[model samples]
Target: MATYDPFRDLDRLASSFLDTRRGPRRMPMDLYRDGDHYVLTADLPGIDPGSVDIDVDGQLLTIRAERTLSAGDGVKWITREREAASFLRQLNLGQGIDTERISASYDNGVLSVTIPVSEKAKPRKIAVSTASDSQVVQAHESGADEPQPIEQ
Candidate 1:
């Protein structure tokens, strides 16, 4: 009791031809900003953790993983659909991202990357001085003998 889709098969065939030299395939990913850090998650199921590679060059982040299929001797294959393939994904981190503190982790067939925002890009509050402090600063700037009253 399985339904067949002709369009799905056709699309798969076309993709196989186009992706022959492009390695395994591009896995789906999600990128979102969480507070002061940006989080990126990618789906990479059935891939060995050791085979996963993450690299950051300039403002570009690259991720690669490989999936291998093994068969035992004298084993008869029936309905083999999963094939060995390499997965590659890249993302461009903009200027506000802190490249030095970028961290990545892989767990449960999912890869998560955390990118911190640069200190310079984060908003900061400026301290507002009292009226007396402003008056002192104004007196210092004017080089007056006594502290002058600050005009509103």
Candidate 2:
């Protein structure tokens, strides 16, 4: 014996209309820096890999995907919940990013993007010339956190 709640139906209807698959939806994602590259992973379940599109325009990175529900010959949906829709996400990559080498891959419904920092942007050691001679000290940029001796 299943009971139907009118309030639940009303709420569902309201959300469905507000959702309006015609409009773009947001994709859940996580971004973090790993070594010299940044990794961004996003969830895109029930979406075709072919429908996924990623592009970089100037400093902006854009992602778009579309999801569609297939209904075959005289098929009826008992309770249609998942709405067919489009997803869009964009981020301003800003400067110091090596946009030319940016790459992305989709696996198991997760979209992963690898963004590498420009060579000049990477932290490097600068050789400090000393008047006293033989030993070499290292000078790093202000934000490098440590100033250690250069290894041979």
Candidate 3:
């Protein structure tokens, strides 16, 4: 026997009503930096690959997808929890992100976007020179060394 939870049902009803009023719902996503690039993954189960659209406009990235359900002829619907709907999400990618090189792929109902960091923004190590090299650089920078005063 299943226990009845009135509060849970009420909450679900309220959520569904609010979602209907809000139009397309925002899909959940996860973003993280990996090495020289950032990866963003969004959940889009039951969404057709051809229906997915991704756009980047002036540092703003947007993702949209649609989900549709079809009922066969002479089929009666009993309880329908999943309905035709749309999902949308947008993110503002700040500076240092190579927007021109951004790429996206979808597999197994998950959408992944790879955003590479610009070359200028990548961390690089400066070569350390030997003491002799440092002295040469110092001499060149000073043009000519002045004679030091001899202490008595």
Candidate 4:
């Protein structure tokens, strides 16, 4: 009897199956955080900017695009293939998200989104005092007479 490793077989099977499924493959995206903002970038070529819509409903961010094409009326036989597809991507943003400050822009087949963190989530710099005017006072113990003014 032999034990099976799910990961070993899972990768091989999933890769082959996904490879066979063609037509407008789901694009890959990169997410990174800098300072107090998080950025999400995705590649969506051959898609019109007018047809793309980005929205954040609750904590989920969704992007959808629709495309259409037309041919002449003189065609005898038709072999039509759909060039448009509804791509739904939902991201569950954890706590500390500033939903009101979310913004998105699409240009040159790329979509960029900047999500600002809540006010409390942003880092703040504390001011440090460097002046020598501040002084520290010491207290004397019960028996220790308030140290009389040092002898001149």
Task: Give the clash count for each candidate.
Answer: 1, 0, 0, 0
Q: Candidate 4: list runs displaced more than 4 Å.
A: 1-25, 75-82, 125-152
lDDT of 4 by residue, 46-116 (tens): 67788778888888887777555665688765544344555546688888899999998888878888989
Query: Quick one: best TM-score, which candidate?
Result: 2
Residue 50 miss distance in model 1 (angstroms): 0.5
Clashing pairs in 4: none
Candidate 2 regions with alpha-carbon error over 4 angstroms: 1-10, 17-21, 134-152
Which candidate number has the best lDDT?
2
Please state the error at residue 44 of candidate 1 in Å. Answer: 0.3
Model 1 weakest lDDT span, ten residues long: 133-142
lDDT by residue for model 3 (1-152), tens: 99999899899988877765447888889999999999999999999999999999999999999999888999988878887888999899989989999999999999999999999999999999865553322223355576444332
- Order the candidates by TM-score, highest first: 2, 3, 1, 4
At residue 10, candidate 1 shows an lDDT of: 92
lDDT order of candidates, best first?
2, 3, 1, 4
**Least well predicted 10-residue stretch by lDDT in candidate 4:** 79-88
Which tens-of-lDDT digit does each residue in 74-125 have in candidate 1?
9998767677889999888879889999998999999999999999999899
State model 1's lDDT: 0.87
